[model samples]
Target: MDSSLIQRGRDRGYLHADEVMAAFPHAEDDIASLDEFYLTLEEQGIEIRDEEESDEHPVPETPPSLLGRRLGSHAHRADPDDSLSSVS
Candidate 1:
């Protein structure tokens, strides 16, 4: 795995140290947040990578809630072939 990915994983809340330590049984208690690890890597002259493939694709934040409770409701409507079909 790339150091940048490890740093990014740590920076984001995705990687839980205590959970990992508990699961692995051999993991150490000494742990640092992603941001902290990033600093250490930077001091070592490690290059930061942009994981995103392109700048055009924006990262989603709002989530799919705005789409309503059911995602395929419209598609499952009576007139499935017609885009104008409405699902109750």
Candidate 2:
């Protein structure tokens, strides 16, 4: 799986250690931890998906879009934002 996608899943509470390990088999090659994943997402400006309302783990529908992922019961990728990392 894509790092960005894995990051989003973790952010959305969908990533367990095994899930993360399974999602990105190559994470051991570079990424060190889930926190590191968040750090990279912050540095790379990737949007983390929300799971409160969205279950699909939707990604930004558009390329390089800044709208962030809008996940209703129907999840749809719009654009990404830096705000996701700050959420509690």
lDDT of each: 0.47, 0.55
Assess candidate 2 and give its lDDT. 0.55
Worst 10 residues of 1 by lDDT: 13-22
> Candidate 1's residue-wise lDDT over 1-88, tens digit each?
2455555444652334433333335324433454465465556554443444223455676557766555556655455565644444
Which lDDT tens digits does candidate 2 get at residues 1-88? 2666655654664444454456566765766665676666556655453435345545746544533443334665556674677788
In model 1, state the lDDT of residue 1: 23
Per-prediction TM-score, please? Answer: 0.22, 0.26
Model 2 clashing residue pairs (backbone):
61-77, 67-79, 68-79, 68-80
Model 1 residue 72 lDDT score: 52
